[model samples]
Target: MDTSFVKTPQIQQLLDKAAGLQESGGNPRLKAIVRDLTEALMALIVRHDISESEFWLAMKFLGEGAGEIGLIVPGSGLEHFLDLYMDAKDAEAGRSGGTPRTIEGPLYVADAPLVEGNADLSSDPDPDAQVLHMTGTVTGPEGEPVGDAIVHVWHANSKGWYSHFDPTGEQTPFNNRRRIKLAPDGRYAFHSRMPSGYSVPPGGATDQLMQALGRHGSRPAHVHFFIEAPGYRTLTTQINFGDDPFAADDFAFGTREGLLPVPSRQGDSAYIAFDFQLQRAATAAEQGFSARSRAEAG
Candidate 1:
């Protein structure tokens, strides 16, 4: 009948000792966190009459929550955090005027076919699908051309399934994927068929979670790009097809006004062209390395 004994001063002293350990030069922010957690736990014990089993269950849930955070960091919004951090750093260094950087999604594949000029990247035999020719010039912030810049491109097939991830065996080798290098004047071009919209895998873990949350799991029609140069910031972004139904409502929240390309229909071809202006490398150490190399090392 007398549960007040659970809130004894000895327990408070024990919590203070734990707080002191967390404060010992590890991280000041972590020290404050320890204090807050201890106070919150004490309040919960006083308010709800928690059992030992319930306490263990709460701990298990906390561990699972941390794992969920890791998943988000890799496959979701946490990737955007790094982009915003780099943007702030660039702002502090007075680096201004370049194409905005965006996050690379989880489906990028390396070492695609290196094609010259323009080539058909589509695998479908459908004659009704419009052929898309995308041409762009890669330039530095000073308006000078960046020759020999490597542009890696990949997109879903006409049916909205990527090569490696689609289980239906519908994607051929390098279907809707190619890599191209910029010419002397920083120009690059490639052709691919228009891709359809796709939804997240049905009945999979990602879809199961979305269903419980009453959320849709559709992604707009878009192409992925990983552009790199010897002395510029690596750009990992996606270009949305203009007429996609979900273009303005991408579930990933990755679509930006400048990133969307205008799709033109002329006879049997669709054309999209946009100039990419990249920021200059700020330090001598970064002048010789590529973005893929840096990503590999990390």
Candidate 2:
């Protein structure tokens, strides 16, 4: 037989106090959420008998790895869970038949070079990289084209590193990132080199936690996109290369069906043709990209 201290009335009172239950001036919704979260965390600490030393070490990790928290969230499936939750809510609200959303990994930099219709993502070329060309269209649930949709795309370089965040200082600013404003037909095309899969920073915060949990922090070769149109809901999604070995085992759990497109080989170039289907927006608020802060280039 076993008993937990968190279940005791004393611990409950402590949790209430810590969660601002007795405060009269704080926001009710925020306070209520904090109270529930604190209670759960306290219960977990008691269940695991977490030592003071271990707890402090975790706090230190969080402090040092604050920059990588974005990676950690998706790597730990929190971002994926958010997608699932949002999908369920949409289904409940009678919304269906649109491209599935996935984790928008932490690498996107805003204000990439915008082009009309066809564009090139790689402003700087690599001699060792193979050329790739991709074409796509954005349409509605009824197969009608969503004209004037913006296709914002980005991907890692062949060496599995992104610009702005690459520590080697080898990549040019906004390398392999572009925003293509589709023509009235809702069609788009781009030229770039294939991206390579990348793992988390070795021994960094995300890596440390993943290693402790016996998991890997690698993502498959993928291209992220933000599709926005006037009357359609903005979509945050990506296309994982089906041929990549890590496609099915993405550490970030970002892999989604219909998003994995196998490229066709042609001498030194590869071609991928994929399209996007978006549902019409029921509210004006859904017509724009999320307000979450993101990195940008001047």
Candidate 3:
């Protein structure tokens, strides 16, 4: 038993053994990251005087929280931080002429119906929901047209429930979800209902965590997009309604300066015109990747 509060050789030896326990083979980056993470955790535990019981309890909480990691990440600002970091890198490289990226919140599903140039996102409309018509043009970084780009769009309903996550159980399989291909002129349009802002489920872990942290889990009305073309970098972003109360204060920190689309009401319907510019993929790997692949990989 070691009874010294000074420099501990046993601690260093334990860390070394732990780092070497995993067979890294030739992956020095992975090994280094693992070692760094483990050392930081150990240092944190020791510095904070965290007991074994407290550590185990925290582990159990994390295990339970793993199911909702998607929500937890954006709620904890990790997703937005990554987006910001990527934006910084892009800025540093002077590669910044395109639609800004946002969080692809955990609700994305890859199996929406594909349409040609225009789509009716909601086949059957909610009686009280405001009809929405959205049109956009997909362009390259140099403002040239990007024809045949696939754009997947999805949004919540009037009651703030996504079609896949509908609580009422009356929604169609892919209701309010559609994928549209850009026309030869790079134009696309869709018809859907204006979605309402939503809050996290009342008794769920996310809601509980927000309450514990004295935060609310409300999100503003927004439409999600996953755009992919042959030679451009895959774009994952969303368009938030300008009039939403939480537009400026999104709980997920997903809102950006240029992403808000103010609607124009026309005869019991709303219309929004937005455009997306995609950056040319500088690398082959990025050119070959799609939003679906990135979402699944993430």
Candidate 4:
């Protein structure tokens, strides 16, 4: 049987050959995943008329940009897709009343400072930056306060550069990052400088791809959070500055309506109040796992 690809009939034969070349009996789930992926790639190639050179070029890009691939996922909407899928599952399971989830960007660093209730996150603050006082309460779906919950938050600097990613010449690993344990009443507060909008690094793979698609890789001013408690599902989310020009036009598509923080000010510092309500964990594996805690466990 000639499996040459002169016609559409050879597509199935090629797919079968590619999927069957791998030995099995080790991780059946991985085998099924590869098989499905192979079929999907085959279909995509045929439907789009992708040439040999084009496929090879894409592979080359992947090889060169492997390190930045994780960063590209949110920019290309996969991170948001996962969040939406999880939300759908939560709704189906009747797990409602939590603050809406958002994408965790690629800049998260493990093991930030664990502050007591009501601490300042502006470690080494800029002289000209405006201060921000953020206060919030974490609660359960049934309206009970969740004490001892870890409320981790990080954001960009006055120049829109993150600490670790931008290579700040500092001894500490975390800048503008803090982890505050909720008070006995489930309340937590932090004071930090208001962050500015940031864009993807220029001349990188993500920037190149964005330029090819006629898009800019700029994100609005926002603060990231990963909140977790003993009996609730982990919440990875962000609070977008509602008045920012790019608030509605984030390149990562992460600016949901519920995640936008209302703007207010008082006496030389800004204030934003947003409460977080988390759902009860449906399973044992879903409870008490935070980003820092997971990193520590590993």
Candidate 5:
């Protein structure tokens, strides 16, 4: 039962063979990763004395909740770990002075409606929703306006549900989403209904796991953004409302110091004035968005 047993020659041989080290023709990088991961798991098992029943039950939970695996990844902090890892790599590389990147949740759908500069996100008015007007400028780290910048924004509805994932099925295509082509001055603005904070589905996989871990599956009222421009590194980040109750403890790990903006009451509407700064790219690859499989609107 000692953890040292997992490091024995027998376990090492088992891990090597299980990761296809004895075989040929597979990717070398993948084989190495698999071996390392298996070795870590073996150590964890010995350290925790994980029962077979407990392991199988966990696997069963994963198998049964395949659809919510995306939600579970962020809630479990794996996706956030990727973000943090990249942030550390950037810091070590002396890449500094840009908006901090964070986890891009699974709900992003590509190709929302494009607008010249400013466009109302909600096509129809909801009597119960509060109007939110947001305006910002995209500039380089030196405060110079970035040309040809595009600000892609999306958020949940007043009911704390996204357009595609809403159970009510009342939202239209690209609801509360817009891609704004910035002006020559790098200014972009839009107005939409304020989105409410949302929690995972009741009795769902993410909710169940969070509850078992004595945590809540809630995200604060926030706006998701993808800002990209030629010659500047693409910025992936979101701004949470400073006043939201869950802003300090976002379940998705999307909250960062420079990304929280407190809104001001402007008569009957709320207004948020926040600017974005992008770092100049050192290579062509940094000018484009990170390659991740995402949902696309036809």
Candidate 6:
């Protein structure tokens, strides 16, 4: 028998010490978890002949897995987890009578320009796509207008690239992005050209991981929002353009029936109006401006 492979009472004592440290907490449930982890690690050391190469390989793979977390989070459905949790909380509190919440997406820029009623937001100089007029009211759960609500909006161009992230930089001067504060009646509107659906970055780390997992990386054509007010809970959601082929199949699983914007063709513009209802802030501490303050500070 190899002396290096010998099992010793000191090894058992060290594991017991680890177990004791984990169990010393006041929570009984956490103590049980400590016991379970200690037992599992001890068993693995005894049963599996884990070579140094295999150990290093496991560490390497874990690092790669950690790096892949953001890719998996958006594509593998964890973004919806927040929505589901909030929905359940709203339902429990009898506050479910608002526009459903959706993911804010990773691309939303916090400090976009604030414009009045109908500002042209299209960055494309040619303007080949149809101009769109989107209007909406921000109302409370009791149907009262939320006059102070701010509506932040962003979307891609016809070629499926956001101004900041696209390599072209042709539209880099903050085109197709703006924020509007609701009027005294809690209404706001803006104009922008319709956007096209685009796949996630192709032939990159995100794509390589998706390809290895036999998955396609694509998101439907949609506009992103971060709506907020003094007392109401902040709402982060997206309005999907109805015409995209992947509208129903968003890889982020963010589509909701009530969140889809109805499209109508006017003489020269596509018209969309959506009303958003928000739940009132239940606590005084929750009524502060943390989200907006953070953005402003940044």
- The candidate that achieves the highest TM-score relative to the unseen native structure: 5
Model 1 lDDT per residue over 1-298, tens place: 2345545788766766777763456766776689678877777776787888989876775565452432233334566677788779878988777787766665666667787777667765646667878888899988989997888888886677877766887666777877887787988888888776787767654454557667766778888887788878667777887677888876666677788876888988888988888777766555443353211101
Q: Distance (Å) between predicted and true CA of 120, model 5?
A: 1.0
**Model 4 steric clash total:** 0
Local accuracy by lDDT, each model: 0.72, 0.89, 0.83, 0.81, 0.88, 0.74
Against the true structure, whose lDDT is highest?
Answer: 2
lDDT of 3 at 131: 93
lDDT of candidate 1 at residue 175, scale 0 to 100:
77
Candidate 1 Cα lDDT to native: 0.72
Q: Give the TM-score of each candidate.
A: 0.72, 0.95, 0.90, 0.90, 0.96, 0.75
Please give the ranking of all candidate structures by lDDT, highest first, separated by commas.
Answer: 2, 5, 3, 4, 6, 1
lDDT at residue 44 of model 6 (Cα atoms)? 68
- Lowest summed lDDT over 10 consecutive residues: which window, candidate 1? 289-298
Better of 4 and 6 by TM-score: 4
Runs with alpha carbons beyond 4 Å of true place in candidate 5: none
All candidates: CA RMSD in angstroms? 6.3, 1.6, 3.5, 3.5, 1.4, 6.2
Give per-residue lDDT, candidate 5, residue 11.
89
Give one digit per residue, the lDDT tens place, for model 5 in 173-279. Answer: 78998899988898889999988889989999888999999999999999999999999988888889999999999887778888889989766689999988999
Taking the tens digit of each residue's C-alpha lDDT, what string does model 2 give over 145-252?
A: 887888889999998999998899898999899889888788889989878899999989999999999999888899999998898999999999999999999999
Clashes of each: 0, 0, 0, 0, 0, 0
Local accuracy of candidate 6 as per-residue lDDT tens digits, 35-115:
677666556655676677977875675576664445557776777886788789878978767778887665565678887
Across residues 1-298, which tens digit of lDDT does each residue of candidate 4 receive?
A: 2223434557665655556645554666766677678777766777778899999999998898876776688888898898889889878977667889888887777788898967888777576678988887899988899996999999988889877776556524577888898877999899888789988878888898899889999999999998988878888889999989999899998899798886696667789999999888877778754332122211
Superposed model 2: Cα runs more than 4 Å off: 1-4
The TM-score of candidate 6 is: 0.75
